[model samples]
Target: MQQTAERPSTAASSSLEIKANPITGQERVLTEGACALLQALCQEFAAEVDTLLARRKQRQQSIDAGALPDFLPDTQSIRDSDWKIRGIPKDLLDRRVEITGPVDRKMIINALNAGVKVFMADFEDSLAPSWEKLIQGQVNLQDAVRGEIEYTAPETGKHYQLCDDPAVLVARVRGLHLPEEHLLFNGKPIPGCLFDFSMYFFHNYRQLLAKGSGPYFYIPKLESHLEARWWAKVFAFVEERLCLQPGTIKCTCLIETLPAVFEMDEILYELRSNIVALNCGRWDYIFSYIKTLKNHADRVLPDRQQVGMDKPFLSAYSRLLIKTCHKRGALAMGGMAAFIPAKDPEVNAKVLERVRADKELEARNGHDGTWIAHPGLAQIALEIFDDYIGKERPNQLHITRDVDAPILAAELLAPCDGSRTEEGMRLNIRIALQYIEAWIGGNGCVPIYGLMEDAATAEISRTSIWQWIRHGKSLSNGKLVTKELFCNMLTEELAAVKKEVGEQRFTHGRFIQAASLLEEITTADELVDFLTLPGYRLLTA
Candidate 1:
């Protein structure tokens, strides 16, 4: 089915100006119809989007005032009743291994051809959302859907093309809090969530449905069932507008936020018609947990590395997610394995073993699938799932586990003795600066010390530092965490980065800007909700 572009909406009362930054090949994807569709969606939903964002602030205020989130009392019946989501689409039924990365052209081709069951073409955490990058990401997805996506590296002289069989493509859009500065409706930037979802669904739904797949998505940073309901309404409206079946689009909500963890069943209930799975977005979940409980001394987290999945809080969260998802007959996906294979054989062997163990744990614990950041780890994850779930696509869903409210609550409030260390503080400072510099320069995913670092990791780094400083945390060396200490560490780390990246690159590049931005956010008296919002301004400038 060839796409029929809708003419740009011309109603003076509702017309929106398209202020997107021009890219060389953007015209192929951002058609008049696409703009019209996005404008219409934004105009229809902007007010409601504002209300939802305000609700997020209200809820955060409550949390800061010593309120704890629990299963909604009004929605207890939804949890009590035994109901399941709509059937999983055939293509998404067995997602034992999904690879995730930014939506760069080369990444789009390589990820799809990487042999994972699904490639989560990420526009959220893993993407640096410059206007050109965002628009070009949509263009890349459009071409990949048509199986015509290819890339030739200018420096490497290497060509990338799709293989005979490619992974299913699932797009992860930016969260609700973000705004697409380049795209405006009625003189205001539209929500990034609306822009990304509307554009992709507008252009690719028909083509994807015709190809035996539909527009699958991974919703991120959702804080409540109401937010899920908002997305449900959008899906319904888009399906009707596009003249497609009501349940054609399937989504998997990332159970990443503290509020979201308590409302998993409710979230699924809200989007029952189109929801298919729930993923353990571990990194952001940790960040959210820390941010949510920053004021409570007992809930202060230790070094970021100390907070692993094995921790009581994370383990309970994982177990509850599996039980909740499987109880609803939805796939319970595992968190990411962010460790990239190293060049040293000994290091690579140790890392691969850790990856294998992690996937094996997920497989055994009833996760239908897991995520791998690098393609090289895909086979390792796949083999674990294949060995454990052979012949049966997802063997563990049928097996049930018990999870009670007290268990979850206890885990959420679990105390840790893990100590902060000078090394950890220095590492966080170094990573925050390095990652932010790359992000400001239009690179979202950076490999530092053999791990794939993205926004989620970066968030944990900065937020942890902020929390430590705010709470007067003491490092193992008995030094109190203070703005002065952080500033001193930042200076040393900046010098190290300057030397590592070379003075020329450091000066001409965004390193100074990145360091300044990181210092400002980390030392600020008030916590900033997102690094991207301020960072986006720099990109636009």
Candidate 2:
């Protein structure tokens, strides 16, 4: 590994101010040097951020006019040409099992020591974007990088620490669409992507390099190759400014949107120098598929439970991801196994069996690794990969199936016969309430009914309700879904939750606020672009 120049100074700058108060002992993480670097990044790239966001809106308008996303004509040459990403870093090569969670202190320690090959410390969907949570998450990352992270719960006296050989750390920053309200430049909030990426890189890039790894990232919700190109520019600028090697910042782009699925080759080509792998963010991809085809009556999705990796559309997407990645010499990572272990012995055994089959399928499909939300499931996923690939970074098999443009588009837009059920509606209402309440309390990932529920799952739940209402979907029992029907169900579920959690905790916490937000978003005349935006406002306000 190459050494970088001397560390930058911690001198405060006049351009930016800290809008949020420092939490106890959090000043050390928000040092003057970190603020200065963030300021520089904001001032230099804020305009470009605006332009890119504007482009997203323009693209959305085109889609609303019944235009389908396809391969960019101008980028056809790059897609057709032969090219491969630069060599993979040693620490990231054999990522057969990766654990993911929010940046909570105990989660960071446990996930790193979870016996997996990689731990993605997420600041995006898995984290509730409270100002204190954001700053403290940076503190936790800094401590983990220095091998000094430890947590002792005040309630249970439980202790946590890192293992002798922890998994490689990869940070998933906020997507391009979010903004960090606490950090402002010239009276405008900084892009959340820039804030999270710059803070982690500015503080710990060299430290990670010293530990034989560099700053690895998982870029989220990218919709086009142009977006990838913009990130490449950001990486180049950050490297030049920090005096680090050009490719020190390795990234894996999450193909989570319908547009991104079509442009995988072009996205990789744009970031070949800094790219390492491409992950099928299956939950969000399904959510995006619903949102993209919102106006097409024929594209209405079935009940969320009916959709899974085995579904024709989802299977096609997964196969396409593996083919595109392997053809370009990059690792193809699989989606999450959100099933957490159940308490009942029989239930837990069944859960593990289901997860085992899922992992085996991924391994058989040539995936380099798969994601597990909880540490207990890691061994199951790891064992399947071990039995299949055995000491190899990834299998040498290639997907020879010829997936054409029409096939890819058709799969995504395919219709389903799964009927809506009253049980499904009730579950969605309960999940939205539960997830939003936990989110308001600063926990982003919550286990509900034997599955890990995050923003993506919540999005799918709420959006499905909205789509069902819009299309006048009927339940399996010959009941029609209407605003009145949903409202009646919401009321019942809310009471159930209150009774379940008890009056004291429910009243003191944000349960009511969570219910109100869920009702507002789900019942609105138009679908909101992101649920977190409104939820975030309640936090900041």
Candidate 3:
């Protein structure tokens, strides 16, 4: 089932064709054992990943033809039955604050010591999946797992290392939709999720277990219960292969897609053996809402800024996630606080205040914990969650929130309130243009304006504009959104971006390419599923 490596100093799988240049640290991360695990994972589960992705397209076609997602009748009995997931480890129980970022060595060190309970080293949204970045990231995490990670800034010569009490580490693998472009197994690209999960788990699972933790994960972009089942099968298969305990590989699934909300109970049941929590992947969920209902004029969203967790649909989403998770004896982790800390004192204080308020809302709404992009936002979130849950408790899982009325599907899919404006449209256009530029340039986590823009937030920016133009929606200024209007505004925004970033940076940067790509997708005949798919081409080339 495995192909022998053609060369000693290359990707270790002969069955897997290495399509990209080998990075400096690729050898250790893609060791023979790691390649073997990847081959095994692909052999057993890769077909299912393709099938599930095809299922997503089939469902989207139905949605385009006027069908809405609802609870699964086939899984009603599973949802109704009283059951709980396998027990959580001690370190995972008090995850009141968790931070997520690209798996950069320095960033990983900083985030681990950021005073959060967990640091999710991300291989998904936050990291642009360049071959060098992916290989280097695996190496960094391997070092972190062994407590030998350290870095020194070249310009400043500032050495950085882990603190005495670092946060627990979790890995967020790429979604099933993404493929590891650098490697192909059995004549098809290996699923990026399996590649990442295999590499990390093979290298670090033993070390983490000895340190009183397994290889915890944050599963993203699940759209249905069957996807959850696929992961469950994957987890069990890996555990059996590795000769580990059945429930050693714990995870917290991200309810990011529009359809996932309707199947939360079944999703929990599917992974109950090893799953421990459900994260409110709000940004992606918003993006999914726009994409899923793009054809429905009545469901058009307003300005991106107006779609906060307080909105009817988002609020219902948060509450339902908590209710579903807590009822199923799992932690309900909150969404990301996208705002980053600023340099100016006033601006920084305002940023902290915003984060605090957002965390407060989450805590009051019964989330067991929350996520922050920057390490600086950790204190604000921890203070809020700590005040709510206190030092005595690990999580708020005991609070099932059973008293609330049922959250209807309509409420979860309600149109966001507030007016779209020429300004909001312009902001969306600018952010999409610049964010795509950065992403294609091998950086996925970028600070555009004040907020951190990753694939999820950027997805909202581009798709919102497309949805507006698709439905001929009007701004508060009474101006109709059209392809022509959007194109004109995009040209103006591109100029503005060039001016702000200066002549040298703009000329050297990917502004023109980004602008063209942004305009193409934003004004497309149909909304693209992901801009990254196209952007990845530019990145790899």
Which one wins on lDDT?
Answer: 3
Q: Write the per-residue lDDT of candidate 3 for residues 140-250, one digit (tens) a residue.
A: 999999999999999999999999999999999999989887788877888899988999999999999998888999999999999999999999999998898899999
For model 3, state the Cα shift of residue 28 in Å: 0.3
**What is candidate 2's lDDT per residue for 1-541, written digit by digit as tens?**
1122222234255666556654564566667877777787877787787788788889988987888776678877876788888878888878889999999999999999999999999999999988778888999999999999999999999999999999999999999889988766776778899889988998899899997999999999998888899999999988888898888899999999988998999999889989999999999998998887777677788789888788887887888888888878788999999999888999999999999988888888778889999999987888899988886535433543445453457775567667678898899899989999998788899999889999999999999988888888788898888888888899999999989889998888898899889989888988898899999887777
Candidate 1 vs 2: which has more lDDT? 1
Deviation in Å, model 2, residue 261 alpha carbon: 0.5
Descending-TM-score candidate ranking: 3, 1, 2
List the candidates' TM-scores in order.
0.96, 0.95, 0.98
Q: Which stretch of 10 consecutive residues in model 1 shows the poorest summed lDDT?
A: 1-10
Better of 2 and 3 by TM-score: 3
- TM-score, candidate 3, is 0.98
lDDT for each candidate structure: 0.87, 0.86, 0.90
For each candidate, C-alpha RMSD in Å? Answer: 3.6, 4.5, 2.2
Q: After superposition, how far is residue 26 of candidate 3 from its true place, in Å?
A: 1.2
Clashes by residue pair, model 3 = 3-15, 4-14
lDDT of 2: 0.86
